[model samples]
Target chain A: MSKLDQFESVFKAASKERFHYSPQELHSILVVTDLPEHEAKLYTDRIRDYLPLDGENITWATLTGEEFDDIGGLFEGIEKYRPDLICTYRNLKSQGWQWPYSLGEYLDVLTQATTTPVLVYPHPEKKEALEKLGQLKNVMAVTDHLAGDDRLVNFAISVTPKDGTLYLSHIEDKRTFDRYIEVIGKIPALDTDVAKTTITQQLLKEPRDYIQSCRDVLAQHESSPKIEEVVQMGTHLDEYKRLIEEHQINLLVLNTKDADQLAMHGLAYPLAVELKDIPMLML
Target chain B: MSWFTWFASSPTSVPASLAASQPHAHHAVSLGVTLFFLVLLILMILSLALEEKLHAKKSVIVGVFAVVSLLLADIFGLLPLSQAGRFFVENPLHEKIEMPVYIPAIDWGVVAIILGSSVFVDVTSRSGLFSWIAIKLTKASNGDPKKLLTYYGVMTVLFSAVLNNVTAMIIVGSLTVVSLEKLERREKLLGFLLIEGLLTNIGGLLTLISSVPNIIVGNAAKISFAKFFIVACPYVAVATALTIWMGAKLFKIEGLTNEKEMAAANEKVQSFDENDGIESNGFFWFATTMTGLFVGTLATASFLPYIKDLGMGYVALGFALIMLIRYKSEADKFYQAVDWDLLAFFAGLFVVIHVMEHAQVLALIGKGLSVIVKLGPTLGSGLVLISASAFSSVTDNIPLAAMLAKILGNMNTPSSSGLWWSVIFGANLGGNLTPIGSASTLVAVTIIHKHGLKLSFGEFVVKALPFALLQIALATVYVLLFLR
Candidate 1:
């Protein structure tokens, strides 16, 4: 099946699922970009057209790199406008401008700093793949933490078309978990195995509860798409790829914890590059 | 009961019998007690000078020193336990009469004013009145650096002239940081802060109650509130403008040449909620009313003999008390906000100066100044201005002001407005010469440091010296031209 065809079919099937969500309709969107001021405006204008949102109800704003650099100032903008969604391009690069961090790093930081769902296109060149195909079908929302993914899940559900399949995926990379357990054990007199077992049990227990919570939220909307939960224990990169291929995930959603840490070693950067074709909505 | 007035009314010319009957040092006090107090005072000054390095609270150091010095004075019979301030009061309604009143070395009037002004300023700041004014200015200036500086500079001067310079510095400093942060001009704020710091002192010079030194010298010289305003306002106006211009050049303020940058700054400013910091409308309005009334009372202090004699301290405290009563439940918070440490520092500093007066140390300084007084008002005032600036640059102006006021009071010269004005300029402008020179400079340095701009003493002095010199020069011109 063609990507668009598969997306529409999956969404239609998902709509039949026993879920409900009284999803809030977005009123405004802010597009933050490193593009030249005029280019940024034009780009956001194009996005507004693609979203097909009525210009009167749904206000669109274009913030350039310079404006984005002033975080305090940007927060004031967020507070005043209360934009429902923030859109931007990932891996942005520009000359004669000193970005506080790399393009991906800034994206990670911005997403983490704000509560508004950030829909980041992999690159401006990939605009067609993200916007043209139009219908959002196989949408996957990924989270390492179980509880905090509610916002991300709700966001994914909101964006997915009625004929789309929304997958809730969690990967418990054993090696990373073990390393964390080892660090905890280094705290004098901690029982490493017992602590590890307690943490593992605690960790493994949350995703199920989180999925149920998400399912309940989705249950609110009458014509929402199919909601599916997937859990895997292995290396994150390989597991994520396997899930994506198996489900034919068109768009990925993830939660960013800390902007600083995300900037230094964000999974988003590597994952975006590896899954270069997939658009991401980071919260 | 008015210690300030009692001391202020000390006889300008000593009678022959009083001078002849003045006891010898050995007869009045022992050498050991004098040496001990001097050594203690020197150490206190040293500790204050090296306050940052010592990492000790200056108030604690000086408070201990004052206690020790007072105890030694008592032990050595140097304390004037029974001394009474005797002066002839010229009552306009009645015949002049000799009046005697008790006077403490540490004048309670100065203490009351400092503490009261501090609390009043804190409450006003908490009410978001200053922030509201700041946001309005930022909006009006549209984030143009030069325009913002002018508005902010004028406001700083106005605030400092009425409120304490330290309090004014804080209000302006916080405003500067918030505005610059919005403008993404954090790198430029330090120079702006330094300039504002200098301007606070210039503002302080505009009124007798503006700074501690002004209060000291103004009281001693019996310079009325209206008289000080009339004399110093023009000098303050000129100095303020010159300081702002010099600041723009020195800081290399990046002018608003880029339309794009200016627009971004304006856009950011537009996002600021003017009501964000305001606690409540009622509180804000009430605080505003009280502030206006307080300033009104101060401006009319000269015209109202009752108010002038009631003292600036009484009025400040009365207003502060009224506010506390109105906000009874939040009274503890207001009290907490008062700078107790600062009050304590002045208390200790006052006692130390008193010790110097009792020990005849002040008399020696007076004799030195007597030589300058002989040069006539123009040159004498010029010399006093230069000396005051030099002395206050290295030490806390509070003690220096106290010491200078006493020395000038003892001189043969009577009612030298030029000399008193020189002291005012010297003490206020001199504060800009060093970070430790005045409480206001320290406050500016501290706020800048809080915002990650660390300025060393040498660096602060380097930035401040040129401005101090210019102000001193202007003050000289004013004194020689008008005051003389």
Candidate 2:
């Protein structure tokens, strides 16, 4: 991805993190220090991907509280709202390590001040949110590196478990198997059934087929993930709602690579339209 | 420390579990891991090749030593411990390759000892520790060479107890020269004197933090800072004294006074900022306040597992800031003089070390050393010093110190020794193994460079080798005699 695209992804992911909480709590109750309001919103939005908000009493603090006095204002703010969890985006600066606050005083302020839980979130703390998103377990590469019809095998491995029947789909094209194989070395084995489909073909993509394909791949290696494939109706927002209703997919994994929706139109639209309660693990 | 240990998990119990049960086991080594190890190895070769004064053979040995580290990491999967999460990356196979584990329980304290002594030279020299001593002796002698360096070794021993050897040498050496210059017209032995001072600094660190590796070990072991200082003081004292005696024998000074020239050069300049003068406010107060802050933090850290919560940094920083604010203009000069780049270097080191910690390759090496030592302070200390001294030849010593300090927090070390001592020993002594090892050596060189003089690598080693050996021996004797 381009550098700008990478930044866009990070921002998109960050925003999903905070989208679930009440905007007022985010805007007024929490004062983020160095993260700024913009970054805080981004973080929330990113988290919204994996952890869909049930609209509970969750308070997200974006500031790095390095000093005892720095927390005093927030302490009182927290007391009034009495939020369930107070999480700070902690890095080197937020520890409040200025002198008079002796480590003792700093500890006292954090633990003694409130009954609410204080959780410090280091950068990239939510590492495993979507590690298990793909059914094959091993996160496969998106590179169309193969030449001529061999991509079907690649798709099989990509979509099926190392020990199961392969289920494959593309947004635009519908072929029995993908073209190209020379670039990918030799294919693993040709026993599993590999087919082509898309998010539009919801009724055809059965969960049993996905599980069987995954099992085929797993015979080669004992530790492969159980694969499941569900078709979303379209790449765009309106289609995702229809797809979610029809497919009833367990999780939605979107790569920022193909989508062309500028700004939030691409993400926020689909996120808003899709079933908000189902866990969507976006990288 | 307690919170972090709890967060880190037991070394023996690998964090990774069957893919079906535990979701958190994906934390393992990535591309970043391979890259850091490569950089460290490349630098080790470069620094040794570039400078002849350092032990070249040892550098090669260390380069091999670094390579051995990989076997102990995640991909190799030699260590049975598996607390780390799995790592995923694309390989040639259609399926994504799923192999990412950090080395189990990497310890950086070994590196602490490697560069400890060398860095001490720079710190002590810059701290004005040696300058103060040199000036006192210089004034007392009226330029008599014999009387000037009579107790050079003794002074080194005593000073090493407080500061590392490098600082002691610079403080003592510089003043000695100043005094010598007082009684003479033409100065010829400035080069020899500075070299000797540099050597003395290396030799004096009998204490753990006084050297790089010792600090690494002490910190890895989770020993207290104060207790380390108290225990290692005598060893430092003896090593320092031995350094001085050896120094005097290596470079003897003899000259007659030029009465007319001496009087003219000795003329004093009047000061404009009267308040800024040393006599204006007692050094005792500054020393006491700094000491109090240092002692307070250490005492608190020893007792409180959640010390970070207590604003320890803020408290110490508060005092420092207050003093800075109160004496703003005055302190600014010193602030300007302070080695800020070194601090930046230190900050970068923490990030690098943190990356290593997350990778876990370092901890694998630590486990190996743990087996050799069987939980004794000596072998643990030996490993810390050797590693620190070896690696520090390439990297900055402070970050090396900090990394070791953090790792020592997670190792199987003796609590009685206090973590700080290992930090002191490895950092201070290990620094001595190279010319870039300590601050005093740098200061001494810069001072010489300022006046248009330079010492070749071979020259430095010749002057420093025996003295360095002597200091380490003296320190070993002291530790054996008292610390144990």
**Candidate 1 ranges with C-alpha deviation above 4 Å:** A1-283, B1-43, B82-103, B412-416
Compose the digit string of candidate 2's lDDT tens values, residues B326-407: 3556654445544333333333344344445545534654555457445465655555455655565444465556555554
Q: Give RMSD to native, each candidate.
A: 17.0, 33.5
Best model number under DockQ: 1
Q: Top model by lDDT, which number?
A: 1
How far off is each candidate at the interface, as Cα RMSD in Å? 24.0, 26.6
Candidate 1 chain A minimal-lDDT segment of 10 residues: A9-18
Backbone clash pairs in model 2 (N, Cα, C under 3 Å; residues 3+ apart or in different chains), count = 186
Docking class of 2: incorrect
lDDT scores in order:
0.72, 0.41
Quote model 1's TM-score. 0.62
| Fnat of all models, as shown | 0.00, 0.00
| Chain B alone, TM-score, model 1 | 0.87
Summarize candidate 1's per-residue lDDT along B175-274 as a digit string, tens digits. Answer: 7776787577888899889999999999999887789898888877878777889999999999999999999988988568888988876766654546
Model 2, DockQ value? 0.00
